[model samples]
Target: MKIGVMGAGAVGSFYGALLARAGHEVVLIGREAHVAAIRQQGLQLSSQGETHTIPLHADTSPAALVDATLVLCCVKSPDTLQTAREMGPHLAPEARILSLQNGIDNLAALRSLLPHTVSAAVVYAAVGLAGPGQLEHRGGGELVMAGDALDAAGFRAFDDAGIAVRISPAIEEELWSKLVLNCAWNALSAITQIPYRALHAATGIVETMRAVMNECLAVAAAEGVQLDAALWSRIEGIAERMPQQTSSTAQDLARHRRTEIDFINGAILRRADAHGIPVPANRMLHALVKLLEDRPGLPG
Candidate 1:
């Protein structure tokens, strides 16, 4: 199978490398630095303290995606619409588009921008770019998608590549749950520039997280998504499970790049405003992150 990965950052590069290592023809469409590095030195993936160089095709142009059977859209939330528009004309008509991105609105955004329905994937991965064409995987690489989005052949391809893929009927609920978790961690961690464990270990931070989760839950309920009580535990447990992992927002701010906070916490704020829900905690976190975003050089 010829697979194309758009926005070949850490997540895209990691998954594309796995498919390539499994003997699939994978092409990564990304920045010039990454494309040049992969074309020269292959993709260097470091995980579990072991590093491997996986040879694959790469390009800076979306034209490379013309022949892909599947296109994994791995760009950040803010880039979803523009990226989709740019890649739409280049993609095969029958190619399956899977939004392997953050937040809850990317699938809809892509579907509206493109001529086809875009499938959503709830990604549970902690990966970051170590260098050009290099990825550092901390933990978690499972993907959850809608049952009807991928056919039998699609499922077989993913299974053959050793990817953990789950098909669920309640995908919207799952996406909302992930959004709740992001609301609890991303902004706070970004403001403090702290890892999960250190952020949660601070005095009153756990309680503050509870407040954030409560606000998100209220907003989710108002949006007609009823999240479970266990969602709180799952959100809290991420710190224990991935103590060293920092929020993507934290990494983005450190690099002076724009974050997905607008889609994460800021999305919650939008929903809350629509439903007349009071979410002071989420509002504060969202505003603080926005401040940092507007002034990237501000010391954390």
Candidate 2:
């Protein structure tokens, strides 16, 4: 199997290395520095108390995706449309594209830009780039993929690569549930520059998270998405599941790069406004994150 990971940051590099290790041909389309490091010394993957340098194809050009059978779109939500447009001409006609991204809007955005059945995957992994061409996995590595278009070969390939995956018919609800979690935690983590365990242990944090999540749920209800009843429990349990892991938003802030906050909490804000539902909690978090993005040097 030839797999191309578009925007091969932490998540893409992690999965690409795993697939490559399983004997599949994997190419990572990433930033120049990361691509250069991979070209020089292969991709370095550190996970489960082990580190290995796995050799694979890496490029900064989308043309590297020309022959890929599976394409994982892992770019930030804001870059979805632009990345899709860049990679569109290079994708094989039969290539299976999966949006292994944060937020709820990326699936529709990609489908609109590409001429393929773009599947959505609710990714439950804590990964980050330790450095150029180096991926560090914190915890969790499961994917709940949308739709049944994944063939037997594809499923077997992912399984052989040590990736746990399951297809779900109700992916919209999954995406919303994940979004609710993001709305509840990402900004708080970003602002505090702390891991999930620390944040959850902070004073008044759980109640604040609940408030944000409830606001997001109200918006989800208005949009007619029937999220799972156990979603809140899942959200609260993230602190235990990935105790040392920080939110992707926190990682972005630490790197002084842009975040997907606009799509995560901001998505809720947009819908809430449309539905005339006040989401003050979501709004405050979104604004604070945006303020931080706009003023990266703002003193804590």
Candidate 3:
């Protein structure tokens, strides 16, 4: 299978390296620095304190991906619509493009651009770029693929990549579940500049988390979507499992980059208004993250 991974960050590169290892052809389209590094030295996959240098194909040009069987649109949420439009002429029509990203609306944004070839999944992995062409895997690489739209062959292709894959009958529900969990952690952790465990332990943290969760649930309900009630138990489990893990939101704000807060917390607020629902908790968290983003960092 020929796979075009549309980002060379830690998540995309790590998965690309794995598929390449599984004897499939993998091409990574990404930023200039990463392209140069992958062209010079093969992508380095570092995990569990061991580093392995793996040879893989890479390019900075969108045109380089003319023949991919699968296109993993792994760019950040805000980049989705633009990236899909850019890949419009380059994408193979038969390709199964997966918006393997953080939030739920990414696939919809892609579908609005290229309606025929987009899918969504709930990513269950933690990864980050260590350096140009270097990917560090922290944990979890499983994915729940969308059930209704994909073909059987699509499922096999992902399985061949060595990913723990599931063809979910209710993948949208799964996506919403992940969103609820993120609503609890991403903003709070980013605002506090603390890891999940520490942030959750702060004064009134449980109440705050639940407040956000309740707001999210209200919006979900008003939107006529059913979410898993057990989602909070899984959300709390993240703090227990990765005690020191800081959210990607925290990491992004630390680097002074834009967050998916608009989609995570702010999405609820937008949808609440559309659905005639009140999301005060989410509104507060959204504003707090925006304020935190505006405030300059402390002395380096």
Model 3 poorest ten-residue lDDT run: 291-300
Candidate 3 yields a Cα-based lDDT of: 0.82
lDDT of 2 by residue, 1-300 (tens): 899999999999988999999999999999999999999999988889998999999999999999888899999998899999999999999998988999988888999989987888889999989899888988888999854747677888899999999778888888888899999999999999999998999999999999998888889889998788898899999999999999999999998888899999999989999999999999999999998898846333
**lDDT tens per residue, model 3, 9-128:** 667887888888888889999989998898899988887889888898999888888988788888888888889888889987887787778887887788888846688877777777
Candidate 3: which pairs clash?
Answer: none
| lDDT, model 3, position 248 | 79
Superposing all C-alpha atoms, what RMSD in Å does each candidate have to the true structure?
1.9, 1.9, 2.5
In candidate 3 the C-alpha lDDT for residue 159 amounts to 79
lDDT of 1 by residue, 154-179 (tens): 77778888889987889999999999
- Winner by TM-score between candidate 3 and candidate 1: 1
TM-score of each: 0.96, 0.97, 0.92
Ranking by lDDT: 2, 1, 3
Q: What global local distance difference test value does model 1 have?
A: 0.89
